[model samples]
Target: MEINGVEIEDNFAEAFGIQVSRILITAATKKLALVAATEATGYGTSVIGCPAEAGIDGYVPPQDTPDGRPGYIIMICNMNKGKLDHELLERVGMCILTAATTAVFDWMDEPDEKLKTGQKLKFFGDGYEQTLDVEGRKIHSIPLMSGDFLVEAELGIKAGVAGGNFFILAENQPAGLLAADAAVDAIEAIPGAITPFPGGIVASGSKVGSNKYKFLGASTNEKMCVTLKDEVEGCEIPENVNGVYEIVIDGVNEEAVKAAMKAGIEAAVKISGIIQISAGNFGGNLGKYQIKLHELF
Candidate 1:
């Protein structure tokens, strides 16, 4: 299939089921919201390298925000609920609460589900923590150096899809980057989805294990590395394709991942130097669900 002069290949992007948490970081203004969001999502791209995989879900308008300020929605995925709770407390307490004019809120729609976001972070108040119920939602106000930082008692958690990715093969680095940028722009507009890659692009993909190191869990994908194509064993890279970039996405569910992937693939395929779109998988052994690109398009 062709979309805007770009070809959609018949391939699948495999994904796995993991625990996810959606968080809202609100501030007095949009600038502060962006700042807190950037920091909260910083150093979080892949669980392979980072402890967690997180990204900006999207921008929340003032009307939709809890504190009536511009806000950003972030989703964090982990292997288990305990891991999610631990990372959320650490990142929010150290990063979001410390940021200026920022307050954390739960993005969950339900009230009863417990994830203990504010409940755990309240310990940072050193016995000065206070709680308030606003609009039927419980929020904890912890005093800080600047002022009180409000956060919800519990966050939402659900089984979601992770490792949703697509590879961009191009004639050169510039073309590959351009295609990846366009894809990210498209995916960012889709709700409940996030591309956690660095600048929404991954230049160095990894394989499952290392050839020499018995203890290493993962290593670089030699087959996709252009520089080492000639020297490395089992490198299947094509000629004239000097660069490759991967767009990895995480979403609340399969539908969300499918929607974002469709948009991203469509936008990416339109670039001039993009050659083919492929996906990353461990021979269908790892993830619970597999998304077929051809079926999505």
Candidate 2:
């Protein structure tokens, strides 16, 4: 299929089922909200490498949010519920709750979901913990040196898809980055999705194994590396195409990832110097969720 003259591959993007937590961070303004969200999602590009995979789901308008300030919704995912809870407590405690003028809430709609955010973070209060219930959500207020930190009692956990991605083959590094930026911008408006990379693009993609190191689980994908094109097997660098970048996304489910990938690929392939749109997969050995790109579009 062609989107604005760029070819869309028939390949599928593989995804895995993992536990996810939705966190709503409210701050005094949109700027602070963005900062808290960015910090919360930082270094959470992939669960394969990072402790968790997370990203800003989207922004909530002041009228729609509980705190009446601009808010951000971020989703954190892990291989299991225990890992998800640990990472959520660590990241949200250090990143969001510590940020100035910020308060956290359970973004999950289900009331029965376990919420350990406040339960874990209330220790920062050093025995001065106070709890309040607002609009059916429990908020724990912990007194701090700076002020009181407020967080919800429980966070919602659900099954989510991880490792949704697409590769951008471009004429140069700048072109690839520009195309990736456009793709990120286009999909930022999509709900329940996020690209958790440094600037939302991965320049160095990894392979499943290493030739020299027996202990290494993953090393660089040498064939896809432009600098080592001459030595690696299956190197397919087209003339004038010197750079490749990958856009990885995490979402609430397979359909969400599939929809976001379609929009992302469409936006990316429109840019000049972009040659091909592809994806990363484990040859159906890893993930339980499979998204067919052509069928999605």
Candidate 3:
């Protein structure tokens, strides 16, 4: 299938189930809220090497937020409950709690899979910790040098899809980045999904494991690297393609992932330098859901 003269490859991006926690960080201003959110979600890109995969879902306006302040909503995902719990505890305590005028809250409620993040952090107040009832909902607050830090006692964690990805093949580096920028912008508008990769683009795509270094869990994807097209045995890089960029998505469900990919691909192909649209996966080994590019339209 062709979109704006760009060929859409007859391939799919595989996704799998994982647990996620939706965390809300609010502050007096958007810039300060971002500072805490950025620090909290740092070092969290992929499950391959990091403790969790996380990103800013979107910015929430003051009117829609519980605290009536500008803030950011983020999602942190991991394979199991224990890992998610540990990551949230560490990141929230060290990053968000330290920021000025910042407060934490559970954006979503799931009784069955709740983590006592605020309950755990309250101990930091020593013997002066307390709970307050705000709008009939009780939240824990801990004393700090700046003031009291308020947090929702329990955070929801439930199963969600991860590892959804697509590739942008372009004529050159600038063109590839242009397509990627458009793709990222399109995906950003959709709620319940996020591109966990840095700036929503992966320049160095990786394979499952290293060929020479056994200790390394992942290695560079040589076939996708245009510079090594002539040297690699199974190079997928076309002669006209001088660059390739990948966008990886994780969302609240399969439909959210599909929607994000659809929007991104549609926008990307409309750009000037995009050649062909494709996807990346570990064959059938990565995940169960396969989102075919052509079928998305």
Per-candidate alpha-carbon RMSD to the true structure: 1.8, 1.9, 1.3
Give the number of the best model, judged by lDDT. Answer: 3
lDDT of 1 by residue, 33-109 (tens): 88998888888888886888989999999998767789999988887788888889888988899999888887854
- Candidate 3 residue-wise lDDT, 1-297, digit = tens: 898999999999988898888888999999999999999888878999889999888999999888899999998899888989999999999999999999888886443478888899999999799998755656888999999998888888888899888999999999999999999999989888889889888888899888899999899998898989889998998899998999999988888899999999999998898999999988878788888888899
lDDT of 2 by residue, 1-297 (tens): 777776667777777787778888998889998999999988787766789888888889999887688999998888888888899989988898779888898886443357577788988888889998877778898887778778987788887788888888888998899999999988787787788887778877877778789788888877778887777778856666788999988877777788788888888988998877777787898788778778877
**Candidate order, lDDT descending:** 3, 1, 2
- What C-alpha lDDT does candidate 3 achieve relative to the native structure? 0.89
RMSD of 1: 1.8
TM-scores for all candidates: the values are: 0.94, 0.93, 0.97
**What is the C-alpha local distance difference test score of each model?**
0.85, 0.82, 0.89
Model 3 TM-score on a 0 to 1 scale? 0.97
The TM-score, computed over Cα atoms with residue i paired to residue i, of candidate 1 is: 0.94
Q: After superposition, how far is residue 133 of candidate 3 from its true place, in Å?
A: 2.1
